[model samples]
Target: MSEPREQRAARFKAALMKSGARSDTSLYEHLVRLLSRVREEQPQDPVDVLEEMSRELKRGALQQDRGALRDVPATTPGQWLAEQQRALFSHARDEDEDDLVETPLPNLAEVAFFFQQAGVGLGGEEMQKVSLALRQLSDARPLRSCRFWGKVLGTEANYLVAECREAEPPGGAGGEGPGEGGDEDAAKMIVPPSTYKAPPVVPAEERGTGTNSSAYFVCREPGLPWTRLPDVVPAHITAARRIRKLFTGRLDAPVTSYPPFPGAEAEYLRAQIARISSGTQVSPLGFYHLQEEDEEEDEDEEQGTTRGRVEENPDFEPLPVTAMSKSLSAWVHHVPHILTQGRCVWVNPAEKPAAEPDEDEEEEEEPDEPEREEGPALFTPLSEDAEMDRLPPWSSRLSSALVPRFAVAYVRSNLWPGAHAYARGRKFQNVYIGWGVKSDAAFSPALPPDPQREFPGGPEVTEEADPTPQEERALRAAAEDKDETEDETEEDEDTE
Candidate 1:
């Protein structure tokens, strides 16, 4: 006996209807792939085969979702897994953050708590999320130090930036140091060019406010990956100053605006972070002192730059927060202004090298010469706050400029728009909250004052001249007489 096709179809339908099961897209795709494999193998036990396939698919997806731990060598499995666990968003704790090393991390929770008084603080829940994100970042990467850079709000979404000091790359900055070369035959003898066509400025100390001083990472959401932003090139910084647009929150989004930018949103964001930090990041007067001379030869040699760095002042006496909050000059800008050519230090290429004066002669004339200019102080005073649309550019106050213990200085910058900073004693915190926009010189579009009118006599002043009845009659009589005189003169000319 043989079964007909119609009979087989009827039997399958009856069984499917009785089971009352619905197949979704995920299940359908899985089954389709499984059936293809089964048909190829002509499996003996389909049930056992399906179970094995399911396990394999699950394992592959797990690896894709939770990334493979970075920087883990072929070591103990348990230990590596533990490290992966630490490098997750949930590793953050309620207490303050601390590194196993002595480097003290900025406490975001406390900053949020203190800055709330100024009305610019990111709320408690958001700050907690940021803490978790930062914790995961520090654990994931080989970081020497990391801190919360401010939040930049975007139209579609927002970016929470993390500033980090990364471990130096292998082979050092120049690729391989002199010692790394194998032998005389293997190594190539090289020397720097005697001079450059356009010689670069002497770069400032690496640890201070140099170009791309620290690494910056941005993330839209706490669960999302922390993307290391591209470095800010000079051209990008110059362009960013001219154009002002809100971040789209997409790293690869094209910048379709005027004075076309080179890269994408990542480049634009990096330039903005540099500008904001330079303008609003400040500290108390003596909080940071400039290093007059190089101290350690090892660090100077490693970085390959002369030392004109900024260091923490260990012996700084606490300034009264009440007095400090009364004026803007009490604080000083720690970051250097990005010059027009997009550099911190300017270089004069035309000047030739000069011979050094004798030590004895220099000492003899030291008392006679005028005081020298120390190329823009490592820390300069914050400029006077200006007024915008009648409102002050900066609002400074203390929780109570009276109480010493609770007195914390809070200054909100209107120039950079939503930048805020708070200082108590030694510890200080700064954060930004609005869209990344620097305030324009004028709030509304300015048209020239209708241009001054061409009036020479200051202004044309006219008064309504009134006439009495007598004056009106006299004017009418004069008009009639003038008409008669004109008629007589015309007749005389015709007769002649």
Candidate 2:
């Protein structure tokens, strides 16, 4: 029987080899596990067992390949698989398509100018916010008649030609051009070519006769002459009017600043005062690239301060962009508004600006009285919120003057409260509806709780009342004595 089985098995092996079967030893272990499971489930049928083994061997080979390639890079799984994909796509390749790539575009300086113009026109809350920022950043400089432009072109050389009008004569010199006229007319005139004959050349000696001599005519390097644009004052004023509109009718409303509260309030007030006194003119002398300066130290300090409190204080608030603008104007002009009126008070009457008052106006004025000076405290708190509703007449006028120079935009109410919640696990998210920011000069929150006192803990043994008590011999003896006496009395009763 054993000899017959061996002969059958040998014949089967020879048949497998002849049919081009390949050895797959890597999947041998998996094949064995599969055979074991099959043998356990179907112990009697050898034919079924063999069929199951064949099917499991195929599955084992697939699983073994997956396991072997598990650590391979995702880009390419197997050489054979990659080759097959390449073969499929390679069959339909297109050769006629152009390979030329488009070049990236260039940035233009004129675009920045256009944005500046457009931003001025936005003229609303954003304008006021911008004005306030500008006022805070403003500095003094001499009157600048020309705005210098860089990166001009050859054909665009004519743009600066009109700017040469200041050097021209009062009535305008008669040049060879067809339409030369008075100074005003010449300023607006366009010269048309009168003749083809070699143009009547104006000598160098005659160049400054008409429009070239006045200081109003801009001067710059001939090679890169600056292009002069119209003054932005009118645009600035328009934007400022927009800003004024936000606060003019609503003095009682609250405002926010960018830096949040406390520190920001002080910083903003200081910057605002600086802006008012300095004005908006920038000095070309000190102009330097921001990248060239060593700002690391200043930045580090700012970061240190901002990082700590900003995330922790929930009640922190900022000034409104509109208020910052108004504040600057009020301070610069010595105008009294809701905040400024009570703060900057009056400069000494004698120190007042020289004014030639009308006789009738002077007659109506009261005699000079001793001016009250501020005590040790520079500022006193307002009696009530109602007192902040009005501004003295002088403050209104000064703010109006600053209207041409600065614009404010984007007046946010507060840096959303997170400061209190971050350091403490205490959550503070809700903001009061229609709540307004007021000066903290009058009130501030309690100091944070002591850290050590708040979180003390440790393991220690503590005594608790125990209901179980140890037996006492003395107490038991007394109980036994009482029991014996009772028994003796019962015996006497029985005897009676």
Candidate 3:
């Protein structure tokens, strides 16, 4: 015969506590070990023992909370047991619900565009499911707000300009101030659209021919439009400003180019490339397109005479063609890949490498091997798969120009202390406007007029030559026909 269930449960509970099983996993292992020992000691059914132990534990719990249990009316044993089982199951279901994590949704427009471009077919139901998933993902994440500031250049129709420099504290002195600066500083910073000037022209001799060459003389001829943004701008703008600030004094600083607008710069580049490849023109806010038109001459005299005409049409401009020189094609193509796969390295300029000691100094120094000390690690070691899982998505990393906007925000908040405070207190805006074309002299001359072929005694006169025998015979026949036609017309008039 088996011992009383209460006695067995009390002994088991004591053993469980003694085993030091604090976590659920350890508790389960301990319970399994205890059951194995009980099986070895007796030939009794393990199921019956387990059931009895459960009942004993439940009774003990009820006894511990006897005061609370007494408040409820007593019921038949069968009904009470049923109610307890139902409650236990319901609690377990709730726990399961809490543990479940929902999947994120994708952007529907992007998804549709991708599928359409890839030539992939999707059924109606499948598309509906994808759209639903995208909705769920979008709903899960909050939207981020962005701000931009720069100048508009060229004819409003066909123009190319850069919107560099995010809004920053107005003054060069970095300190806390009256959040609002003087009106004069604000006036200087906020350049109106109509007043923005075209990019200043540096002579070719001064500008040099290097792609990474620094501007020797920035043409400051004021006429083009300029825009100034207030402090506390959008995340992307803050990132752009921070990056530009980082390279302030370094002449050989790395070139970090960002898109004029917000969001994934790679996506923008890809779309631009696709549009240009398809022969469809794209004109962003301040860029112009150069189109070639053919002019036709009088067809009767010169049947196939046509001349090539190159014209600038502000209304239709492709970004790649207008924004930068053709030499930047490689860089443009490489930008998307870097944004997706590259990681940023933060190096402190103040830190320098230690110099090597002389041979005499090395001989005088004492040799010592430091003893290794053992200590608990602060961070848990992660497997390769886990580390890969922790990495951000490509889209997220490349969502903004140069570096991700979030990374920039992090740098500002952590590395550049007081930057946030300074930005918040300042009322004035900082804007950097760059134009594509400075002056006619800055650019290479257009194709020179085709060299005219010189003939001896100037251009030959084809009409000066006398008519051939065949031509003369035809002319005489035409004259005789005209005379006959006139005579017939006169005869008809007389008969009438």
Please tell me which predicted candidate would have the highest TM-score against the true structure.
1
Prediction 1 TM-score vs. true: 0.56
Name the candidate, 1 or 3, with the larger TM-score value. 1
lDDT of each: 0.69, 0.28, 0.29
How many residue pairs clash in all the candidates, one count each?
0, 36, 15
Residue-level lDDT of model 1, residues 216-258, one tens digit each, is 8988866567898866656677678868788988888888777
Which digits, one per residue and each the tens of the lDDT, describe model 3 over residues 72-135? 7669866754554342222234545433433232233443333332232243443443344323
> RMSD of each candidate?
19.7, 34.8, 35.4
Clashes of 1: 0
Off by over 4 Å in 1: 1-104, 169-209, 295-306, 348-376, 383-393, 401-405, 442-496
By lDDT, the better pick of 1 and 2 is: 1
